[model samples]
Target chain A: MNEGAPAGAELLEVRGLSKFFGDVAAVERVSLDLARAETLGVVGESGSGKTTLARCILRAIDPDAGSVRFNSANGWTSLHSLKEKELVPLRREMQMIFQDPFSSLNPRMTVQQILEEPLLIHGERKRGKRVAAVREMLSRVQLGADALTRYPHAFSGGQRQRIGIARALMLRPSLVVCDESVSALDVSVQAQIINLLEDLQAELGLTYLFVAHDLAVVRHICDRVLVMHRGRVVETGTVEDVFERPRQDYTRLLLSAIPSPDPDVPLKPLDRATLNL
Target chain B: MTAPVLAIRDLAVEFKTDTGVTPALSGVSFDVPRGQVTAIVGESGSGKSVTANCVMRLVQPPGRITGGSIRFAPDAGDAFDVVKLADRDPRLYDLRGGHISMVFQEPMTALSPVHDIGGQVAEAILCHRDIGKEAARAEAAQMLERVGLDDMERRMGMYPFEFSGGMRQRVVIAMALVCHPEVLICDEPTTALDVTIQAEILTLIRSLQHELGNSVIFITHDLGVVAQIADHVVVMYQGRVLEIGTVRQVLKQPLHPYTRGLLQAIPGVVPPGERLATIASVVGDADIETPHPLVALADGRQVSLPPAQLRRVARS
Candidate 1:
């Protein structure tokens, strides 16, 4: 997200999005805007409905109420209003990357088959073109072409994640929803993947909804941060505003909980009792 | 200086697989001081867990301790050589739960799904102490409460599946500390938990260790966790101990090439938009650059070599 992004151009907009599982409200009337080529972070504890909110925006699972409007090449389109048949082409523009690279990717499939599958699903049937696209994506993700022949089990967790990224970027999606994508990796490998994500975003002008529990990662990658607590958005601001001067007690508690790598800064987690968490 | 509670010297472990022998730990050595948290930090397959398993005498089958001496120095009397002990040694049973215990990353694997929390914790107490069931249960209740689990009586009756991941980890800690083990091996205990839960657990473990005055061997890849809890740090890579010192010394002034690269490459520590310092992916011998006589930290005053990798070649 840089100078090329149109001023005040909105790529995706969610208005009062809500989802409930039986009696429980998984996501409660959440509203946010993702600018073109901007990376927005969603941070919260487990079971705080961040994942549900992401799913609703992507229409991976339908929201019970509210509307999701995405600015397609054709212009503004309501994602929820589109029928399943009409949603097919747009689905390519909105893709998702998962946390566990091991389980998300098919163990039986080679890297080639895995990357090519997405193109096939979107109706790109030419074998030569699919192979070429897959190779290009692989290089972009910093994985070599030799990796195409190996199974997921053959690669390390980091390498498998790179393959996963390559697969997600194969269709050149405009928006990518990364749900705890880098959380599972070690710090070093996590850095490598983050760098790759940043590079790919810069080159291809991709928008990312990076959902993670690590506040440091959110601060590092996202232009703005959204803090969620038990199915509601508690805070949303620029990374500096939320991290340095958080308005909500819940946001402050989450920020206080992050362990600084510096030894001099002792970890001081706020008491849950104080915030009534 | 007081003798260390655990002393590992020239530790070498290997697996006799179909492909051939693969060394897991070769000449890994470190001293874990008494009442201090010594963190063994390494990436995946760095043999941190293997070292823990070897110390616990839990390694089986093709996995073998080819060479080493793991000495457990009790507060009183003789220093027992752990590596020389037989598989069925009766003392291993006592030393395990009585003196040393482990809390793992996955709490589910440690806690039985069928067993009630109280019963499992009480069983551990009974295993090490000559106590009645009622007395053991009472002590178990205290342990559970100490681990930050409120409503211990009610939670004790619940099964593993009924509790959240963080709550279950507390139960695991309770069972591990039931016998009051002198050495606690926590292998990435907070790795699976969220940041808030991780902070709480780290605090709990630190407080418990402070209260009990017992030594802890915490194995993790997260440098931030090491900074949070460790008094002493041991940096390992590919089964070798590359650097060893107090946490301040290791983290603040890293001497090894790999350690330097690791510290600089972390995301949050460095300002955003700057490209992170990266170590070479292939890391057999880190003498990739021309050996300079010195290396710099923040100001490059210490010695001038490559800004990231070490200038000098030898640690010995």
Candidate 2:
């Protein structure tokens, strides 16, 4: 359990994180911090290494270099330095909502089985308690009890994502990395899931590492933004500061690329010549 | 009004399963103007892609075009009903890639992993035109460069896997346009790419459309894309055309409740939570009924709204 790390305290911290696959540096010297309850958007295009950075921080994959510090009820734990057995307890605090709802969830498993697995893994031996927790989480996501028997294949993209969120919350994790969670759903369904995410964050005081390619969704959901380019942080600032008055040309270029829904807002897309960065 | 480059009248398609028949498209109709982008916007099962598939005569087995006429009036060819021709007919063969080529969502599916980029581009040209290998290759290189894939001498020799997603998409665009098709059907062409890359691809398409003067039937669920490039908008819901109008008319003053719901659902269009269920309680029963005949406006725009919906818009 996160044993009272103080209100508004830093939940997670990373410094000079880097990972290399052969000659290519997927994430190079990336540093960031997350407050107790804040949504930080990690914005990038393909090959930008935002996903690799998140994976490294969560210890889903090992980072070649740098450090990670996480605060729990046991106080500050140096996560990068911890061994596998020692890290097991801390693993429950960090969970992930994946990009594809279809592939991320197993088609064979019922919603009850899917949601209850996390609790079972974290040593909730009592079957009734696990089911109750799953039920509670499902309701929080606006899916009722009747969904318990349904398979992932039976549900729509939006409902499947809700199940994914419920699965992520079974352990009541403090940090949930939403990796393009809403992007795959249809426009209307995307809005519903986003609103659900927002509501859950407020209710549970969750810290979010939102990695996405959609600028409009990022702008709406996130409080602060980190712009990544070619495995490096190009800019990190408040959403307004980065969006309205971006410093680097690359950041400006990313901003310029977002297609506005309003037709009257003339498209001044930066030329493909500028994509070399 | 001048005849549109393509007229889709009462388009209907059905997908038959062992259980029963599912009407993928029922009474869908719209007109695509000459040298302009007509965007068909809808959710997943809304039959937007079905409409596009029917146009190219690409709908496969079990999915049959039951009724409708896709009157394709190309720049130089005589107007013909695409539905009347068999899937493998000679006339249909000429129309499929030679005149109306399609760009799919996944470029990898269209492109061959084994073949060199130059070969694929040249193959597209050689299929439709009576040209030699070297001439086709030369034309392919020119087109590859035209779509902004530079260093063609080296890059053209590389396979589709060697290129990035955006680059592969550019090659797909180059292939679709190299044949000099009068009609380009882009079905969610940029849905898989990054926003920056998507923007770039969109710009390239718009610019080339201007240069070639080919009418484009852009099928996308993204209204932002529809707003960005579409001259006309076709809104669909549950396998039918909810409304049809210019981008201005459809987006600014949507005659259908579903269109309004979709537009409002775009992030930042409305407050977060409220936009979630906007479509649920909205869109009355009367508006969704079949037999919706398009009502023309003083402007070039048209809508298939019910009397109540039309009156509501008029008052607003």
Best by lDDT: 2
Q: Give the alpha carbon lDDT tens digit for every residue of A120-228 in model 2.
A: 7789999889888888999999998999998999899889999999999888889999999998989888878888898899999999999998888888888899999
Candidate 2 Cα errors over 4 Å, as ranges: A1-9, A271-276, B271-278, B281-293, B314-316
True contacts kept of each: 0.70, 0.67
The most accurate candidate by TM-score is: 2
* Model 1 iRMSD vs. native: 1.2
Task: Note the residue pairs that clash in candidate 1.
Answer: B292-B311
| Candidate 2: tens digits of C-alpha lDDT, residues B57-99 | 8899899999989998877768989999865788887887899
Every model's TM-score: 0.93, 0.95
Evaluated at residue B54, the lDDT of candidate 2 is 88
- Candidate 1: stretches off by over 4 Å: A1-9, B281-316
The DockQ assigned to candidate 2 is 0.60
* Docking quality band of candidate 1, CAPRI definitions: medium
